[model samples]
Target: MEALFERVFVETTVDTDQDGQYDLIAVYIKRPKLDEKVPAVFVANPYMLHCNEDWYDLYDVNTNIQAYPSQNIQREDVTFYQKDPVVCPKKEAEQIVENSPYPEPDPSAYECISDLYGHLLERGYAGVFSGGLGTRGSDGLTMTGSEEEIFAFKSVIDWLNGRARAFRDKTRTVQVLASWCTGSVAMSARSYLGTMCIGVATTGVEGLKTILPEAGISNWYEYYRHNGLTLPAMDWQGDDLDILAKYCFSRALDPNDFASIKPLFEKNQKTLQEGEDRQSGNYNRFWDERNYLQHADRIQASVFVLQGLNDWNVKPDQGIRLYEKLQELGKDRMMLLHQGQHIYTYHLEDSPTLGLIDRWLDYYLKGIDTGIQNESKIYIENNLDQKLWMQEEVWPPKSYKSYRVQGNGNQMIVDDLSQTIYDRKQKNTKAWLDELVLTQNAHSLSFDLETMKEDTRFAGRAKVSFRARIQQPTAILSAMLVEKGKQVRLTPNLDGDENHSFVFKMEEKPSDYFVITRGWMNAQNRLNNYSKEAIDPDTWYTYSFDFVSNDYTIPKGHTLSLILYGMDVDQTQLPFVVTEIEVDTASIVCDCPIE
Candidate 1:
């Protein structure tokens, strides 16, 4: 068998001076003959052409390098050597040379042709190159346009694919792995190429903003200057990047220390016009960008997104909604929400939520079927048990049952019972109009049941059906659940002020041991139509409605109580009212037979 290798050098000139000296030089190794069986690798270098002395020293002594028989070719067969390599001017080389002696060299420095050649050969990769926008020496990093970046990425794939046909005459599938923003751009391109793209969120210009702020540095450029950290010219940007960097740095500090600057990031959430501020626009933009609705359709990969739920800038809801959209789009994707903010943290290493991301990515990328695709696998920490609970269905399952509210005196029981009441309007039907003023502290009337013979479990949605005449034109109805001799459990109100009959759905409750479900109607919407089985919409009627369902387990000794009331129950919010009312059991049944 014969081995083939080709060496090529690229010299980039900044000016058309025709001088022998070139502004930049690059070396490349092409093994077009061996392209079929190996992965294509590209190493890019923005500075320097030859191997650094340290790398040469390692090459001379390291057993790993010596063990590779293929890399050590016969001296006679070696075709290329630089007789008198042009070096950078002494003054310019001083800074570059001084920083070269560090224990660990910048990974970018080793992106030369020979270094990349050795890496690919040692790793058994066949395709390799060292050209891109910067190959022509036009400030490769920043000066590289988005189009050129796209082209460079495509060229790498093309070159590799080209080799497969030329070398082995067999077509091979290619996969790409990119670092930094290059990964983001490459992944975007991969979407067009119909290839799977795997990339790392690398440290680069964006990283500087995050890193510098955490280090207590107010200004990124200033920090670099004072700390002697090398600033790659490609990292340099206009004022937008600088401003963003400063903003990020300021936000990195604790809110207490920088209370004044907090408003800059915060959005004004007030509903009234008088409370409006600059934060309003900022918030709108933030929500617009962070909202799942924005990129609901753009995601093309089997995205495994790991976002910090506690991230101040990017809320957990953002990722949650994105995951939901992906599910809606029927894309193969997963999302992991952790307790840490913005970036992954070592401090949270021992945290249980931290491993969720690792497990998810491992299962998706590594082709390990870890059962992550199961329906609604939300691992929520149970506040009661302090352990993660895996739910098969959605969080707070929909199979809850609501027990209709029935009353004997002030006592409430979970049962179905009819109450004949006087119609307030006609004052003729077996209905009585009882006027109750709507107040903030309006007591929710309850119908208590007789002592239970056996325990019962009630879990699901609960509601209250009532018929009453409103003295005023409009009012608000609110319902709440309360354990016997305890405060109200969960309270939710109707959407708006109205004078009509309607059914309100309580937010789903977790399965638990409980006695009753309760309901309430705003006295203002007291109009009810007794002609239909449900309350009427046109005119006021007479009947205090208590309808509750879902599911709850009643212990043997506990009594089930149903309470109905009018007015907003959230103490922090404003209040409303309800007028006349009559209490009765609502006759609504679940479609599915409850056990």
Candidate 2:
């Protein structure tokens, strides 16, 4: 096993930093030594290779929203992001000898979960790991979701298939061939690594068979922004594409590599920052290039989507959009929406939705008839019962029905819009919900929904529409649908478990409610999230959007309610601006899928 392990650099076709040559991708090969060729499982990730010394640092969130634009945004601002890459400087690239310019790759980027990859290798296949272009040992700049970045990942598979070149060392003297493997490849991982799988699969690159994207991102725009509002992932305030790119610009770790590309890297940062559109938070060519769903027609590979329904980091919508697209295309695909947070579900118990991923890969990568393809298209974990897994032939289930409520009386959120935002810095969700249900507050609007007579299932997204106008030119609009009674819920097991799985726990004294799902948007982005036209003060703007997809059963006798609030403590950004919202209580419309 030791003798078969080797590190190599696969040459890519682009020079993201344009330092006079095509970029190189750093890869580590682990294939079986058997005479019979096997398939390969490739992981093209930025996190596992050379990485930034530190994680993403927050940007200044104290600033106010961008002033409403008086006119349509400049065309140059949109088209510039789509400019073609510069012509390769190196018609015939110069050879970079081992350790000549960049240092060796540090394998400590990921926790090296021997349990997962080790098992795959034992199944008589090769496993390849790569920190895509612009990581520590690789050339180019780290621009997430760029065409160059996607092609660089595809380049590794090209190497495995003998269509691209890879050198055993920087000398470019001895070549490392994937002679022990078949051309078929599958990419399987969680988070950004999984997202790369979607990006590469969209290219429809030959020899790439399938992908298992667990908690992967399909649209980079949605990841960083919500309805024209800068909403960074997790609790990372003020984070955007540039900050994320800077975080993965791992090449800076090597002194020699850093010095050679310092100017280029700095320029890359400036370009990224400018294009990210942090101020307007509107979608542009920058976001469009990163949206893999738009190119779904090019995907030839089978896809198996796995996402944590409770995951906010990558969000369920990331997997939902791509999987639905594949379903619409009549492509071979499957989806496993689990109750866990942002995590891999292979180790989670198999009512066998995820465990079948092994079989799915075998069918695609090794031409095995696993019969997994004959199974249902969707497998969703029951949020009410973590151990129970359910399957459905179609989304929303056949029995799905809509439950809705309209605003009864107008209510106002008391945050002062005339002044800079300071009141919403640390809004508490639970406390806010408590006020809405137990002690009605002036800062939010709550509508009591029909109570469920029997245990009722809700699967799929919930849409909220309402007519509202604020005292200011712009405001943040947020909504939530909740179960007004306590229920044991699934929570992530963060106690250092090997699986990083989930556990169902009931609060000693169950809380007042559980927010089924929620959504937010910059109210000014009414026509679409990509548009940011100024809203006339006191003019009614209709806001409508779907909350994150969810699957749960509201207990019998438990009432449900639709809560409209000024801020979402978890997802939205801080300035609880907007002095008051003149809401048409009767204008609130909810399309809730109940089964």
Candidate 3:
């Protein structure tokens, strides 16, 4: 065992000035007898090992180390002691009495337990612990100040410096990897340590309720309750930051305490809420600004984020915002948005998701250079077609072309073969136009496209433009894509009011050659925003609706189709409209070009 054990000794140093110190160190220690050619791997949890019990158990069994029971034991071989059986050095023990600034049974007492555990585990190539504040009290509004919190956070820098020492002693290299959770303490620790931190966060909402049987309040709602009110079923609730502010206000036991924290909390909550409202109906507000992306510009370590677009607890855009901010910061980072809800991405399949996490660790902690550095990828689960689309680039690729709807008197064609309009009174025209306004039931108008000569692979934005006059003052136009011949509805099944034009944006997937872009205009506001272009009498003001891009393969000899309606069959409420629908060919453009 002695021969197999690496001759590495770990020590720690502190740099109080914030200057980069003990930098450019390897992440792991290697035995002299082992091959020097392989790179070392480093892993850490700033909190106690119990916080990550599964990982702790795995590492203990793999390394053949004796697992510590929940209770502590006094053993010289065990460098650290657990909180259940407190241990203190003789000299520092006296300092607790002479110089202690905290009240009796100090909130920081847990630090001693954390230190003892860390000291024992310091023998390993890596360390792990929790760094964030723990929620206490029945309402889950109060935070506990434990010794473990301080040790978990402070020990991150300590461990990094120790790993550097271990590398120097072994004549090798070392890396520092940290993981944590929660918003306040985790972020606070990250700001102080200036090291790479990885962890999952919850906005206090349960995303599992989306697919699971159990239903609970969303994090936003919890936050709202903490703010002394419940969310109104219908109303534009400002922004993400505003919601968070409301929560903070509710949670403040003493409104004057930590007064500085309120403004930032409010601002972040509103910003996150607004962005989320634009993309999804889920009440979970997860914004990168207050969590991961706050210090993104200064982070030197590679960041990897995994999130779910369909997660009802955390807004998917939080991951996107981080990815965008990382790109802007010119940092080495990667983000993966899967077709899953919260916590589902951790499961393994024939094609495993955990395998991806392994690879990410291999590249970052082991410095293996797996060629994933400085790249971004998005995996969109097409709810419309039930397929996945993987794109490598920034958000909303600029290459997407915006196709316009053009056609008058019914038979619509997109390609440049020929322009022909069909009138009920005319001959030689293929199809006739029928204008039906939706008054009571949702009205639908379908158009068949001309046959295609070859397979067309479209990649980009798709939009619908039409002239609409509502019988009532206000109306909503709901659009959807369907199969040309089969007339299949290609929209995802969702729960909510369909009359809202913004609700249409939540459809993560739409069929190829089919799109639904909705418009809500009151009859009093019939005048279109036609300042840039002239409106032809033949065509009423053309209103454009944007849809999520569809990377669809239209088979040869098949036609493209579009459906316009006032309401979805599944929706409770209905839209009112008077429609003269026309479909036309429109150019599609991407949001950004891929390099």
In order of appearance, the predictions have TM-scores of 0.32, 0.91, 0.39
Clashes of 2: 3
Stretches of model 3 off by over 4 angstroms after superposition: 1-134, 137-330, 335-343, 348-352, 365-368, 374-398, 409-478, 482-545, 549-560, 564-595
Candidate 3 or 1, higher TM-score = 3
Order of quality (lDDT): 2, 3, 1
Where in model 1 is the C-alpha error above 4 Å? Answer: 1-179, 182-352, 362-371, 374-376, 380-384, 388-390, 394-398, 407-442, 447-468, 483-538, 541-561, 569-572, 576-595
Lowest summed lDDT window (length 10), candidate 2: 96-105
Report every candidate's CA lDDT: 0.28, 0.75, 0.30
Error of 2 at 218 (Å): 0.1
State the weakest 10-residue window (summed lDDT) of model 1.
58-67
What tens-digit string does per-residue lDDT give for candidate 1 at 1-595? Answer: 1234432322232211223333222233333333244333333322222221321110010001000111222323322221233343311121111000113223353332233234234434333334333323221221211222222333333333331011110111211121111111111111111111211111111111100011011121221111111111111211122222222222223345235433432321121111211111111221111122433354444544444432323333334444455567776554343333344321232234324433443343343576656634443322112223323233123454445444332222211111222232343321111221111122445445434466443333443444443333333344444334222222213222212222222336532222233233323223321011222334555533333222233445545543454332211011222233333334312121123
lDDT of 3: 0.30
Q: Which of 1 and 2 is the better model by lDDT?
A: 2
Give the Å error, residue 465, model 1.
Answer: 5.0
Candidate 2 residues lying further than 4 Å off, grouped into runs, are 1-3, 53-55, 73-114, 350-354, 398-406, 416-438, 494-496, 500-508, 576-578
Global CA lDDT computed for model 2:
0.75
Q: Which candidate leads the pack in lDDT?
A: 2
lDDT of 2 by residue, 112-184 (tens): 3234676787777777888876787788888888888998999898988988777765555556666666899
lDDT of 3 by residue, 1-595 (tens): 1112221222223221122232111112221222222222222222211121221111010111011112221223222232442232211111111010112223241221222222212322222222232111001111111223222333334433332122222222332122110111111111111112322212111110000000111122221211111111111122233332233232233345335344544454455446433222212222211233444454444555555444333434434555566678776555555444433333312212345545554554444576555344544444333334455566544354333344444432121111223221233222311222211122355545435577554433455556543322223344544334333433322233321111112334432333222222211222321111222335434454543333444556656555555422111121122333333324211121111
